[model samples]
Target: MATRRFPTREELRVWRDFIETGELVRSAMAARLQKDGLSPGDYTVLLALSEAPGERLRSSELATAVGWERSRLSHHLGRMEKRGLIRREECLTDNRGAEAVLAPAGRAIFQQVNRPHLRDIREIFVDALTPAQLEAAGEIMAALREHLTRE
Candidate 1:
């Protein structure tokens, strides 16, 4: 039986290379986060909250920022809350909606988790990217994320 023929190269050099690179970065970051008693998602939430306008964010917005569905965000938040890392408050503007707020414990963990995470990122990813490449990478990711979400 004959197999389908393929071209030597298509138009996916960036995509293909990135997938390989992304997994490398993810693995390194995951291991680093694990040493700090956190997962990548947990670090992301803490990072997002720390950068959020008020150290708090509406659940819906958090879900979007985290690239998670509402239910997924809720489940993660529940775990974070149980671990004393975050608190959920009923949104006054929308009785049914809630906000995820970082607590003091969460803030400290952010500092602890962040220092090592940043160092790991610097070593594993940032060092691997040139200034131009770094900017382009962010631009590409933001553009693709928006483009895909819109579709």
Candidate 2:
């Protein structure tokens, strides 16, 4: 069979639905997070640090964990540092490198917001889907991730 050069009407419709639904979900989550004084980026960074050994990670590792470029992460880290959410310290093992550490304030805020975040997720996503649909969604995500890695 020849490869199609363009999506069929049905494929286009599904693509639009997927993109729009993703944006809606992202918007809802961002709104909820903002109400608790954290952006999605902030939450992502905090969560990574909170899970790392010693509640810290090297700056490059942090950028990778958050899937952000070094420059973007550095700027955001600066803002977060000013807000007392995180601190950068010279890496003990590498004089030229630094580590992102979850400050006490960051940890406290993360703890405060985590439960409500979960509740929002449950209400906005989980409750909208059947258990089987949820499982299928997970599988779909895995497939997409695998495909992206091959590219």
Winning model by lDDT: 2
Candidate 1 lDDT, 1-151, residue by residue in tens: 5764753465467668879988987987898888878999899899999999989999999989988898888899999999999999999899998999998999998898787777887998889889999999899999989999999
lDDT of each: 0.89, 0.95
Residue runs of model 1 more than 4 Å from their true location after superposition: 1-17, 130-151
lDDT of residue 93 for candidate 1: 94
The prediction achieving the highest TM-score against the true structure is 2
For candidate 1, the lDDT comes to 0.89
Candidates in order, TM-scores: namely 0.75, 0.93
lDDT (C-alpha) at residue 20 in model 1: 91
**TM-score of the candidate numbered 2?**
0.93
- Which TM-score value belongs to model 1? 0.75
